[model samples]
Target: MPKDARNQSPELDPVIHPINRLRICATLYSAGATDDRQMKYSTLAELTGLPADTLSKQLKHLEGCGYISRAREYGSTRAKDTVWVTLTEAGAQAYVQHVEALKAMTEGL
Candidate 1:
């Protein structure tokens, strides 16, 4: 629990924010657990159960928001590029803050 978890604005209403969406962000960022590296789309899908296309689109949105980075790589083939996703500094901070915010909302009564 965070030091400030006990304090939060009821008006913020974290339930509306939902857990799974947050889970997607947090879990993906957890790739930092090993060498602060990134992960692939298939890897994330295995963890989050979000379809590839769905994850791709949502990831693009996160990238647009400056929360995540998306890179496309060529594998010596003419087909679509393999994707790599990583958390930017902004993304890591946002994940931490979002977790803190949600923890505050769920603090004991």
Candidate 2:
């Protein structure tokens, strides 16, 4: 292995290693790639194909760790409320590092 590759053996981030969370991070990362860093909760739900409760649980965990931010947007009616989610700077950095680790592990394969 190259020295740079050898030095890139970053530990996998526990928070992002789970499939659900990894998907979430990947979605958010792609969104940011298009200059749209935030996404609606409904959009994330649709992308992940996860039930509401399960998605909520995962969001809460990511938010608790300061990896993501959640905000509520309310319209004139109670039915118009929406939740918005965005990946935080820290979260992006962590996810990128995790990906680098994955790449390093697969380099020789």
- lDDT winner among the candidates? 2
State how far residue 51 of model 2 sits from its true place (Å): 1.1
Write the residue-wise lDDT of candidate 1 on 18-38 in tens digits: 455566677776767222577
Candidate 1 to truth, TM: 0.73
Best by TM-score: 2
TM-score of each predicted structure versus truth: 0.73, 0.85
Going through the candidates in order, what is the number of backbone clashes in each? 0, 0
The stretch of ten residues in a row with the least summed lDDT in candidate 1 is 8-17
Question: Scored by Cα lDDT, where does model 1 land?
Answer: 0.66
Report lDDT per candidate: 0.66, 0.85
* Ten-residue stretch with the least lDDT total in model 2: 29-38
lDDT tens digits by residue: candidate 2, 20-90:
99999889887882224579989999988989998999989988998899889998887899988998988
Measured with C-alpha atoms, the lDDT of residue 101 in candidate 2 is: 75
